[model samples]
Target: MDTPCAERSESYIPNAIVGYGYTEMAMQEMDEQGFGSDTPSGARRVSGVSSSRRVDRQTGRAGFGAQFRLRFSRSVMPRTQKGRIAGAVALFASLGLLAGAGYEGQHFLLHDERFVVPGSSAIQIEGNSHLTRAQLLSVFGEDVDRNIFTVSLAQRRTELERLPWVEHATVMRLLPDRLRVSIVERTPVAFVRQGSKIGLVDRTGVLLDMDDDSETASKGAPVQYSFPVVTGVSEDDPASVRSARMKIYLKFASDLDSSKENISSKLSEVDLSNPEDVKALIPDHGTEILVHFGDSDYLDRYRKFEAQLPQWHTQYPKLASADMRYDRQVVLEMQAGASVPTNNTQTAEASDPTPAPIKHAAPRPAAKKTAAPERGRPHTKLAAMGQPHFPDESAPTGKHVISSKPARQ
Candidate 1:
């Protein structure tokens, strides 16, 4: 009778030793025939079933590895929008906490008194000559006690510079409890005269206040300054015109300052009332003489006048005014009733190339004599006077002299 398949399969493995020997023999036969060789129907079915089981097990293992990789990737990466949003929120929260800590630290530093300027002893000032220490302190005002971190350096500088003598100011914190201030004071170049009021002004035309008693004391004494007074510039004038005039005045003053004779020291005032013809007042023998100096060649003209001043003064003892604007000649205006000395004719002719020769005509007859001139009446006459010869080749060779009319004093 045909046995059932299960029963036949079970009888094939009835004993362990027999089953193991049968398995080894099957493996040897398979190796000898090659793994892919065709076999009997029963062996073929068993081999096909073993191969399918192995392939299924390998496929299951591959699927399990793939699933493991997918789970690991999902765990490590922010795959969902919610996960990405949560990460962004955590990053911003950390930044906010850092910002709050910084804000608190800064607030504490600003209020700290260790950085505050306590008093004048803790503050160092430099470059101030005309401005007093009190004046600079006043500029700090209520902000003196404020912490250095809270102090407005720009504002303090502006306030310090507002003082008339301060041209520029710099303010800075010098570490814990100290402040440093440096000032550039305006240097007075000349005095400004406007309608009887005199004020000090710098080369740039900035007016400096002279009304402060502290400023005078800072200079060590209430002294009278011997600066040349600049006239004719008014506050009503346009700024451009005033600036131009100031530049011209400074140029003239500088030239005088450079002279070997120190002519600037003798200068009493500068007359700019007539812009075309600038005049300078110089004290000569206790008399203030008005000197006409045209716009150019200030140094050359001044030197020439200085060289001939003594000779001219000797010749004309009462010299009232002088015109030195001429290239080669300087016209002299003498006091009325002054007679030209006879011996000076040769001296004057030798010194000046121009001027009519001194000629004495024969006395007119007595009949021509008119009524004696009134004693108290003033007599004015025009006289042409020659100038001293200058060795400069740039001077004009042609002879020229300006006639002068003495005015009643």
Candidate 2:
């Protein structure tokens, strides 16, 4: 290097890259290192700058670090903006493809024949007791042979629940040509007599008309329920009113049978006309007498009646009804000159066929149509006798009254 300044300065100037991420002093310092005594006056006067190396050993090139820094820094910002744009395009393209696939799949499900409900056999029913398949199938008659997805499950469920036997029903699509219907049948709590028509009633007071086909079919046997006949629930009464009366009736039975001795089984009929004073007809020894249990303490009242029955039977030879609602005494009604309703007399005859018919208010006109029961099985008739009058708490003398604890005893 006879003339390092002239030779190197010429080469360094050609390769020096001016760009961002650099200071003026660094460039001046780099220039001083590249040049020495022979450096030109114009180049030596430069200051407050920084720059990269003047040469690359491998290629004998100048300003390699500076060129790389300038190119890399300059491209970083522009490439970042370009990368965001490209990523946005790719995301939008993926979403469009997904939406298209979804639309196509939905179309296939709606119109595909493979998914159509074939026929009545494609429908599956479960959890039915007395409900026949024909009766439940009637609800989905229109849905048969239609696309399973097109069938409104909610609408079918509502229609199924409207049937007398269904307390709750669930309808669902069973995929690829079928619908499934599940029914929760209403439980029969008591035998309800609407006029002369005998049916079963649930706790909610909804009357259930059992399937005639199932009963008559050779494969299905007749369903027999051991329950007392409940009165005061009429077809004309609103469901709320019927339910309210049924509540009182349920409480009466629950309380009487709390001991599990089947105390409630002794009752042949229960009158729920007055919630405040519920009445039950019980057969003790031979004669059946109606006992007024009232609203609360039914079990206690029933027990008290049982305890005092021996003394009462001895004292009164002909006992018709007893009011056990009083705190200390039970009011007794004698059979002679008694004003018992026709229901009591009729039920009495049903329980004991030997009893002669007692005279009552003239029998009401017979209904226009009555279904003749099967020859072997007899239907219980709980004829309504309007509302019966029980002794009031205020007027003890209205009927014959005696202390619950007898002085003689």
Task: Output the number of the lDDT-best candidate.
Answer: 2
Residue-wise lDDT of candidate 1 within 246-326, one digit each (tens)? 888877877877756667766766766566777887766655566788888888777777777777777666565678777
lDDT of 2 at 118: 86
Query: What lDDT does each candidate get?
Result: 0.60, 0.66
Instruction: Write one digit per residue (lDDT tens) for candidate 2, span 12-103.
Output: 33323332334575554555556332434333322222354454434434453543221122443336777889888898999999999999
- What local lDDT score does residue 374 receive in model 2, on the 0 to 100 scale? 42
Clashing residue pairs, backbone N/CA/C < 3 A, model 1: none
Q: What TM-score does candidate 2 reach? A: 0.64
Off by over 4 Å in 2: 1-93, 215-218, 284-287, 336-409
For model 2, the local distance difference test gives: 0.66
Alpha-carbon error at 179 in model 1, in Å? 2.5
TM-score of each: 0.59, 0.64
Least accurate stretch of 10 residues (summed lDDT) in model 1? 62-71
User: What shift in Å separates residue 230 of candidate 1 from its native position after superposition?
Assistant: 2.6
TM-score of 1: 0.59
